[model samples]
Target chain A: MYSPACKVTDIASLIPQRSPIMMVDDYIIEDELNCRSELAVGADNMFLDETGRLSVEGVLEHIAQTAAAHIGYLHRQAGETVTLGYIGDIKRCAVTGPLPAVGTTLHTHVTVISQVGDVSLVSAETSAENNPILNCRMKVAEG
Target chain B: MEKDELVKKMIEILADEFEVEPEVIQPEANIKETMHLDSLSLVDMVGLVNEEFGVEIKTPDLPTIKTFADLYDYVFTRM
Candidate 1:
């Protein structure tokens, strides 16, 4: 059975997003085992590329942020406030988008591959209009 | 390692990072001029360089990287 939607509020509540650096309106998909969500490219955000479009790099960051939200949601669900974390490696990353363009929303998904101690290797994919925007293997370090 | 070898590696790294062909990378070219990479990419490249060569690459140091040769010489020397 599919689980109920978990509201992922502001990016600040999850990660350390300095003003203008943070992307995503809210992340709303996460669990101990997996994570998925969607975020829109608003008027703000520094990821605008030379084409003045929301960039593939920005999409990668947005998806990574969504992954962080999953961690935060799982923690909060268990009565934890927040935990420190960082993306270890963004390997095998691929992107296909005009990027930095408005009117685009990315559906970000992350699945846990393996967890050795406090580090988790996540398999991630983000799509827009059912077309892939980015996919990568990310390592997460917890402190 | 030879500076030429390092330059080749730097070019390779940029090509890998941008998913482009190494031939497209001008040895005497400005990365921003040919490639449209952002700051985060620069940071990631620095991390890649540091991890591969055990060197500390700061953003300020990026200014010295004009051509593939420059990148090769710098990494070969300091890193």
Candidate 2:
């Protein structure tokens, strides 16, 4: 069983993320409820140009990674280390342009929706700076 | 409205989108669990759902479905 919630900032101590892959900037928790957080997009990846332009797929990946950030936090609170897990499934992928930012600060929100076996399903939505960007269903597990 | 007919349609659509054969998928088969469909394949599966069923789904909802029965239920419910 996993702990109720943990601060996103505290999770970095438990998970391994270097530069570009470390998208989540920080996390916020209040009264044991995990709420808003921010994620930063690196200008260095090929998927994202210095111009801040990116492919729809790139936008989708960033959103997916942000969802992973929440799972990482939950794992740490559970007294377990983050483990390897695939992206699992992405259903409706809709994107308009490169994520509009030379660098983006995305505010991410995740809510528990369903659970199957050991996997916990969460629904996520994010906005970069101030614009709504993407919505995704996420699944997390530990091996 | 027929489950068998819908399954046949699903088989044809899956084969065409995933570039396999209709016979390759059986009622007992699971798309991701048995067919070895990765994330990219799941994206294509959504496209197939859009084309075949005219239902719009987010990429995340696809993974929530664990079995053929779940998917069939989802599609039928939408229609």
Candidate 3:
């Protein structure tokens, strides 16, 4: 039950996502190498599958945005604006449990594994209602 | 670690991660060419080495390490 340092209203200022596609609603930076975020699932969410559960793509996007928010926060701390970042690669991605339905909140934890140049490797774990849902490593490059 | 032991360990690690045969990792072979690595995949290699050997491969030093022998030397000296 980590408290969010940045609320839904401030999410837009940290990451580039906007509107219906925006996944992260709350964010918290734990330290230089770790962060956490949450996304509240809604019926109108664009990423829901026909089975009425959040799709795998949605989960991956959420993880990616969490990493984006981490990078965004660091840049802001350095007195720089958030830069566009691309998903250079994803590795060891696995769906570990059931997907969330509307009304559930997705909690994600991200750890910075390494960074060389403008590219960073991050490990992400997402859970829905305290049940582990997804885990993966992502490579994000500043664009 | 001894150079022979380090070289043996690196080959097993890199070959498995890059999905190549262990025998293909010759000392004088061009690492990028043998591994078919682009800029993005090159980062994967760096991460693997760091994780397995605890050696941080600096991005700027990448150009200096052209062959498998150079990579072996880099990790051996650092370890």
* Best TM-score among the predictions, by candidate number: 3
Error of 2 at A13 (Å): 2.9
Docking class of 3: acceptable
TM-score of 3: 0.90
Off by over 4 Å in 3: A1-9
**Model 2 lDDT tens row, A1-143:** 33334355653654455555655566654322245566565576546655566545555555555555555655666777776545666644454223656566667676544433344455567777677777676554434
List CA RMSD, all candidates: 11.9, 7.8, 3.0
Candidate 3 Cα RMSD after full superposition onto the native fold (Å):
3.0
Worst 10 residues of 2 chain A by lDDT: A27-36
Candidate number that wins on lDDT, 1 or 3:
3
Off by over 4 Å in 1: A1-3, B1-79
Q: Write the per-residue lDDT of candidate 1 for residues A1-143, one digit (tens) a residue.
A: 22556666666877766668676676766446676777777766588776667777787777667677677666766788877777767788876554436777777778766544445557788878787767887767677
Q: Is candidate 1 or candidate 2 better by lDDT?
A: 1
What order do candidates take by TM-score, descending? 3, 1, 2
TM-score of every candidate relative to the true structure: 0.58, 0.53, 0.90
State the C-alpha RMSD over the true interface residues for candidate 3, after superposing those residues.
1.3
Ten contiguous residues with the weakest lDDT in model 1 chain A: A112-121
DockQ of 1: 0.02
lDDT of 2 by residue, B28-68 (tens): 56778556776445555664676578765554676767777
